[model samples]
Target: MYEYIKNPALIHEGPPRSATSMLSKPRVPLILVHDGGGTSFSYHLLDRINRPLYGIENAKLHDGGWWDGGVPEMAAHYVSLLGKILPEGGDILLGGWSMGGLLSLEMAHQIALAAREAKSRETGESSESSGTSTPKTPIFRVLGMIFIDSIFPLRLAELVGPLPEEPIILSGEHSRTMKLKDKVDLNMTHARMMVRFWQVPRWRWRDEAVPVPPTILMRAKEFVNRNPADDQSFVDYTRDLRLLGWDDYDEEHGHFIRDLWEVNGHHFSIFDHKYLDDVTKKVRKAADKLDPPEF
Candidate 1:
């Protein structure tokens, strides 16, 4: 088992790299971003899964403010922070739920751009002369992505309601007694950013826009509405995503999504004990594709 760190200030304990053993170098880090709540600690259930896993919570959680940054800004910020944590020339895997999933995709796209730029620079420096030569930059490689029941062009306003005085989650230990006002502020701020990101015509990683990396989407069987007015039919939602060019299934050996697993629960409840085992196993299997087990 990976040693869990307890920190009141941090959304997640320790860094991406945790000790697996003294002799073996830690595996590539699997970084999971936070949902709209801005706390990655919600993924505490994933702690039982073996791998170098780290959660990227919003900076607002650490610093006192709401995250008003758009998708591009948020991705860049995460990339900058990640540069310090991820090992140079090491593999990286990104995953997230809801808004976090969308953010993760953008992050992967940015990382790909950075990797390409790094390679091009190195190639240019090394070559005496030539534009035809391909330079390899192994400094950073994205293994893949994992998106948990995420939807693009997010309509989260209807869903984000007044926060309860008491914490909703009983499983994981939380730091502070959150106020209703703070919760409302965070939700509104995040929703605004989500809308802004949606309005952008296209995603330009560099000279070329790129699709998200090969992803494994863990979809909930149903979309349960906590509030009746915030209702969207799961079937219709899936169709909309497909129309937006979201392919949740693998085809041949190309395009973003590689696999789709439907878990037995509503969007929020999918990560609970009833469905977490299946979700965790699938994730572990995906990790194995990048680094095969020695045993």
Candidate 2:
């Protein structure tokens, strides 16, 4: 967990320095997960959002640990951490960019599961044959979700078609060279491998158990273009749907996306200085619709 303090007044000196002083306030915090690069450094640039902001980076980046599971397992691990981070659990807005977005969705799902289990335990206490009651865990409520240019992995093949026979390496031999000593590079390699082989489960949104929160998709205005000669960009190909490939999936599942807003740049450049303001503005608009924090 990394804290990005936009307002210096939020911090206070104490016997032991506390990194979570902002979280102690009545305001609902916004937690952004790391992208495929396994780092949340980019989120630090979003200093304009008028809320307490925190970033959840990959543990591997700090403790030199490795993740051996897929999205569900990873989300469960983060959810457990949140239990301790905010002992007096409260509502929070969750979101992420790219791979982080997918992970956030899974995290929200796991949180809902925990809430359901806790509710069941409370209701079933009277029927227990042995009169032993298990304590319920405090679950953090997700007020909403903001997906920043996150693509649906399961629909990638269907939307983009088959990969070309020849590998498309931008920098030729230079791209093949791996920086073994660099932790970011190593983490990126592992994350990409996991993404490539990941089998996204065919899970449906169960409104009874896991009610979908207010969700918004912040899509990039420009499409990703790899080949200069290619005339058709992703935007052109996906013009009919206008969702960048999420339309069909959103409809098939639960139609949870309440709105879709286009930011100023392409996927990679959305965070750049030239376009970050527009992204921040859109995020603020979405955040305004969320329910107020409950202290």
Candidate 3:
């Protein structure tokens, strides 16, 4: 029942001047999560990927960010959202760019929890919900997870140095916009949100309690800064995730079948191109590893 929202800007059959072979293929369904910027529309690159990319931007499901409602509650709501959109028995892979990636992992955590709970409560007797009998377990589960240029571990960004404190004040070169101090303040606010997310006592890592999912992490290849430590630190931060049992990740790998093409944008540019062939090939490859592909 997971229905994908189709955004043409996200899908690329190929740029106007290019090939048609790629355009003719079937589009795969992608469940995309967006980074916080009040706009999920930014992730339109999925249109070009081999599969159809589904963008689930900030959930109006829980207005004030899930931190206030509790990550577990928010996480469960998201998992349910995935369920509502997908066709029954459909296997969907989860992935996100930046903060989106982090949440995907969290979704994995939520599923793992539900799976565990269902197992624990399995009684021979039938169960009833709202006075109606139903199956004893949750139905939705992810086939895999992919992370793109994502952030890892709380308080990790500080090690990378502060993000731009405020919006560039100059609209052009002369007009002033946001102040520098404002930018810093915003970063601080975001930091507090992270702290709130991790407020789940003993819940810092997903694998701590939940079974980790098959994970695909594609770390940034280019350096974000002149500081060599920044690059190394980012790697180190994610490396810790491996200890949770995700070591097979491809840091800079893309499909060999399709010529590697970038969407020409920020870190999450994987979707920018109209190259559905690339995504088709990659998803097929990934599907082979996890489960059989849908026709």
* TM-score per candidate: 0.68, 0.73, 0.56
Off by over 4 Å in 2: 1-26, 62-66, 129-135, 155-182, 197-209, 226-241, 292-295
Candidate that scores best on lDDT: 2
TM-score, predicted candidate 2 vs. hidden true structure: 0.73
- Please give, for residues 1-295, the per-residue lDDT of candidate 1 as tens digits: 1122321122234223334453244556678877766666567776444566677766554332243456667677777666556434577888887667777877776787777788677777668565555544345667788877776554443444443332222111222455635654455355444544454334354676655567877677665764668866432355335422264222322556767676667766767887777777776777666554443
- Give the per-residue Cα lDDT of candidate 1 at 206: 61
lDDT tens string, model 3, 70-166? 3445455667776455535245667666666666767766665666555545543335334556653345567677665554445454454544433
lDDT per model, in order? 0.59, 0.65, 0.46
Best by TM-score: 2
Looking at model 2, residue 115 earns an lDDT score of 73
Reference-based lDDT, residue 279, model 3: 44
* Residue 231 Cα positional deviation in candidate 3, in Å, after optimal superposition: 12
Residue-level error in angstroms, candidate 2, position 189: 3.2
- Model 2, 158-274: lDDT tens digits are 444343332222232332353424556555555555555566543433445246667888887776675768665433455336665677767755787888888888777889998
Kindly give the stretch of ten consecutive residues in candidate 2 with the minimal lDDT sum. 7-16
lDDT of 1 at 35: 73
